[model samples]
Target: MKTSSPNTLTEKLKSRVVLIALFVGSMWAVFFLSVALPFLHLNEHGVVPRSLDGLQGILFAPWLHASVGHIAANTSGLVVLGWLCTWPNIAGFWRATIGAMLGAGLCAWLFGAPYSVHIGASGLVFGYAGHLVARGYYTRNLVSILVALVVVSSYGLSLLFGVLPIYPDVSWQSHVGGVLGGVLAARAGAGAANRVRVR
Candidate 1:
């Protein structure tokens, strides 16, 4: 069997790290640009409840933020949880991200307060947590199970409270939708893997 050489492994790791950095860097870039050009009013592009014009937010909301504190809070979760999702394969990370974005954005659009603009990456963070936990349940693998345990231990409270409407200005709808999307993505990915193995 061919095995990856030390250099090859190092290169692959570096690539993955660079990719994650680029992803996070883009978010920071958008935030900084928005701050520098307030006339752009990027926040207005966020999900607006039940409005035709707001539908665009499903694709844009995750990249937009209302404030520095908002993005700062999401940055840690994205770096950590996003990195975790890359385990085993990078495709899983993209799948989880797309699923989370769609789920979170749609939920925020459908249920957000009238005329309120919902923005931030919190939904993606929640989606990553959901994907990790659900991947364990669906795959029943040791690595996945351990990762899920770690996620639950570290983020169980946030997952629980984030989906609740107790916090004013918080998008609990997006949180709930993100988890649903993540779980669905995990299940679909597991099923595809299973089919491939059976062949």
Candidate 2:
């Protein structure tokens, strides 16, 4: 009988500063824009424009949002999903992060629609959701599967609605793009994480 003693990618942290820093930093920045400078409309400069003629849209768009509510929603999702996506395997963690940026940027480029300035890490959220689901199935890990299910259940109860033309003004294309980014990243990183476990 084979006993399953899988290698742990990351044991609980010696200090929570790194994670807390990321979490708090994300929240703080978002809140600053939402509450502090929202009246000033400080984010007009960083919308995810349909065209990436300048790198500003690609680089800074995700950080800016249309409204305080928009930033707040994305911030909340980030606080929870950001940690979950990166907390496990070190390899997968980095993969997801890079992949998410790549995915969001790609989505912003491809399906941004005309004059449809997009922004926020929702694309990255979709990217993480895609990563969790794909990683779970590929690795045959129950945790990944449960995570995928939870993502589907909570984050996207109306996954198809997000994909289809159910809601106007919302870019489902970015969501799809993020999913593609996540799949690519998870596929690449899964093997690497598994390899580390076996070694």
Candidate 3:
């Protein structure tokens, strides 16, 4: 990969920080509006399994939450892991997010219990975690490996529980799909980055 000068790298890092902040801020803003505008009934926009109408939820579900608590639980993880996903750059982050949203939404739509709605950013959070961990194994980069280690150490145990069906209300299917999507993102991204370096 072409090395960036110190000034350029610093500027890039600053931009990344801004990007993450704006993304998370938007989520919070949406949540606040959902609260302020009860007539909007934004929660109804979440993914409803096995219904044709639910298909649109794939685009909106990640931004909707059942309650303030639901969004609150998702906020910290989304901010931290979301920022990590962007470390390689915004394009990779967008790829990971879109991939996870589609994968997780499709999984829930296909296998989730009928007449159920799934909302929250947990799936995307899982995707970010999975991407961070898998990128190390795929790329064999020291920085990626170190990042993987940190992610594993911080959230590995929770991830195991999150993917299981032990919690009746939780969407384990989304978790599974998120993991697959994240690994796929890591593979594609690492390959692309390596090719760039080779050229």
Candidate 4:
């Protein structure tokens, strides 16, 4: 039940465009650099469950991908869902992102299989989707709700499958954690986008 004026909305949109650019651009940059410098073994930096060293991955894992294809698969969701998250405000986007990152990494570290190193932006993608969907329900905003419906219609089935343990190669734990994080963000920022008077 919050509304933003045309000018405020425009500014928010513009800010989000820049935020997304920096986001995707950073991902691409890291991927290219990792490819260029194979010896860096960037993939090794991902979260490894129960390992003290893996804790750092909580902050770095989302920026690292297993391969070009992996990052490509997450690119669309990151852009689209990320955009929707920012539609409310850049602060909300950051809140969701940080929460998801921590949630996914922590869960993967704690619950993932031993000797496994989980990596990729998929957790963040799931987080973005979760935030948008849950934000609608929590805030009861028509636009947010519509965006949620559209997301559910477009990627609901796939999202459902991603969280299943059937996929050996995927870290379903991360997916679950990411979603929980998004929901947490929505709850934390419930009043972040409340209706405001336009001057």
Highest TM-score against the true fold, candidate: 1
Model 3, span 104-148: residue lDDT tens: 888888888989988778889898899889988998989989999
Model 2, position 59, has a per-residue lDDT of 55
Query: Would you list the rank order by lDDT, best first?
Result: 1, 4, 3, 2
- Alpha carbon deviation, residue 144, candidate 2 (Å): 1.8
Better of 1 and 4 by TM-score: 1
> Against the unseen true structure, what C-alpha lDDT does each candidate score?
0.92, 0.66, 0.87, 0.89
Of 2 and 4, the candidate ranking higher by TM-score = 4
lDDT of 2 by residue, 166-197 (tens): 68767676677667778788888778777989
Clashing pairs in 4: none
Error of 4 at 10 (Å): 4.6
Per-candidate TM-score against the hidden true structure = 0.96, 0.76, 0.93, 0.91
| Model 4 C-alpha lDDT versus the unseen true structure | 0.89
Q: Compare candidates 1 and 2 on TM-score and give the better one.
A: 1
lDDT score, residue 156, model 3? Answer: 96
lDDT of 4 by residue, 23-136 (tens): 988999999999999999998999999999998889899999988899999999999998888875678889999989988999999999999999998999998889888998
